[model samples]
Target: MLHVSDIHAYYGQSHVLQGVSLDVGKGEVVSLLGRNGSGKTTTLLTIMGYLSPAPGAITWDGQQIGGLPPYRISRMGLGFVPQERGIFPSLTVLENLTVAARRGLRGEWTLDRVLDLFPRLRERAANRGSQLSGGEQQMLSIGRALLLNPSLLILDEPSEGLAPLIVQEIIAILHEVRAGGLPILIVEQNIRAAFAVASRHYILSKGRVCFTGTTDELRDNEAALHQHLGV
Candidate 1:
């Protein structure tokens, strides 16, 4: 569904993402795992065109989208949930979803379906984004993205800072969301939860893809897991 090849990105000539590459297949959940500042978030931002890569390409369904604007890339079926959860603090839960609930190019994602995916969204429908719990805010963030009906959902650090139980619920919901038929691109620090839901995994180091393979492949290579992921 998505392809990123030999991509290189920079922030004011700092030169991050040196020849990074990976792919997300249709109806699959893929995880990108690495230590902090390994460039996982940058990779997703680049794919969504938030930061254009200096070299290489990001293609969706075979069309090159390397240099497009962020809005253009998003309109073309890319939905991103950043680590900060970018919710509108003043908007009510429903309003938050409504504000972002456009199907952009193709009309498939809807608020109703978003609530179906997250029952808590229905329960807190009237609360402002600031009034919701951290877990609720995360759900709202995910719901907001779902309303876009993206062909591929990119979630960066969805489990970060949440309690263990909430983390488990979020993981379950992510698995359920993927089961509902959309490809998922997850960048997570929670190795166990990430491995549970991801069909394949990639480990980044020094802003490059040092390892890429199925979950089982990663599981079997104990040394590789320790050296790259410390798992």
Candidate 2:
């Protein structure tokens, strides 16, 4: 459902993403894996238009989206949950979600369904974003993204800064979303979380793709895991 080809991006002459290419098919979950500074998040930012690619193309459902603004990309059915869990500190959980709601787009993800996916959010409906625990904030972030009813969901480091149990919870929730046939492209340093949800994997090294394979293939390739992912 999404394709990125030969993307090269930079931050004021410091190249961050070089020749990075990847794709996520309909109803499939793919992951970008690597150690810190491997350009995983750079790939995501470029795809989401937070950073523009110098020489590459990003396409969604066969339409080129390279250099499009983030709002435009999001309106076209791309949902993103950043590593920072971008939530409004003063807004109540419900408000944070309702503000992002896009009705009648995909029509499958609603506030009710998202609450069902994350029951904790229901209990914290009146809580402000800054008042929640780290896990609750993450849940709020994911729920807010789902309320957009995106055709493609991209999460950067969903498991970061959470407890092990919370990570498992997030992974289970992601599995449910995938079961409903939403395509996902996740960037994760947590190999275990990535393996739990994604069927395909791409390992990056020094701003370039060094490995691309199925889950089992990556599992069997000890060198790639050790070298690129530091697993």
Candidate 3:
């Protein structure tokens, strides 16, 4: 339910997302894969309006949101979980989710539902964020996002810095999330996790979309993966 067309963004004088375009249909999961400097994160930031796109368009459900403020975009049912996992270190797990709790179109996600999606969070409901492990923190991040009941979820590096088992758990959780029919736009370095939940993939190189296809197409085209993602 989101479309980005030829968007160009910049940080100071340095161009970041150059003519990058992609789309996420309703209930679809798409992953953006790229090397460290490929502007994947920048594209997300631009869509969320943290960085305005000067030369392109970003539309959600048909309305143009190219330069809207982040809060305004979020209010329109777009949720973003950045790579930093912006959980409040001092707040209890329940408190964190409660803080971002809001009603959306379906109102299908509640604190209890999110806690069910992450049972470990239920056990640590009263614990502070700093007391949790890396995996718990990641779960908390995604849980907090779900509390918003966003129509489209944008996640940056959800599988970064976690152990294999934890990554698998996160992937399973994402699979369940996908089953719930929420469209997702994710930027993940973990190829396995990205492929597990994403039906489609977009590979960026030097700030532009160099490749776009389904997971099976990506698997068959190993040369493109090696060229754009160095995988």
Candidate 4:
């Protein structure tokens, strides 16, 4: 569903993504794994059009979208959940979902569907974003993205800063979403969570793809894990 090939990006002349290439097929869950400053987040930002790639192609469903604006890319069926969990602090849960809602191609993700996915969100429908716990806020973030009805979901660090149980819950939610056939590209620091939900993995080192394989392949290659991911 998404392809990024030989993409190079820079932040004011400091090169970030150097010839990074990866693909997420339809209904596939892929994880981009790397240590801090390895350009995993930068790759997502480039794909979302927040950072433009000067020399390569980013294609969605076979059309190039290298320099398109973020909103335009989003309207083309890509939903992004940043690490910061950009929910409006003053908006109630329902209001937040309603504001970003967009009819998807399949028309499968309705407000009720999202609420069903996260029952705690239904319980706190009236609560302001700031009033929820970190895990609840993370759930709201994913829920809000689902309201967009995106063909592909891009999540950055969905399991970061949460308790183990909450991380497990998030992993389960991702598995459910994957079962519904929504493709995902996740940038994750939590290796366990990433491995749990991702069928395929890409490890980046110094702004380049150093390894790409299935979960079992990664499991057997501890050297790659330690060298590129420091795991």
lDDT string for model 4 (11-75, tens) is 88798889999999988999999999999889999999998888999999999999999989988
- Flag regions of model 3 displaced more than 4 Å: 102-106
Write one digit per residue (lDDT tens) for candidate 2, span 83-182: 8999998999999988878432557788898888889999999999999999999888888888888999999999999999999999999999998889
Model 2, position 97: C-alpha lDDT score: 86
In model 2, state the lDDT of residue 154.
93
Please identify model 1 stretches exceeding 4 Å from their true place: 103-108
Off by over 4 Å in 4: 102-106
Q: What clash pairs does model 1 have? A: none
Against the reference, the lDDT scores of all candidates come to 0.88, 0.90, 0.91, 0.92
lDDT of 1 by residue, 3-46 (tens): 99999999886888999999999898999999889899999989
Pairwise TM-score winner, candidates 1 and 4: 4
Q: Per-prediction count of colliding residue pairs? A: 0, 0, 0, 0
State the TM-score for model 1. Answer: 0.95
- What are the TM-scores, per candidate, against the unseen true structure? 0.95, 0.97, 0.97, 0.97
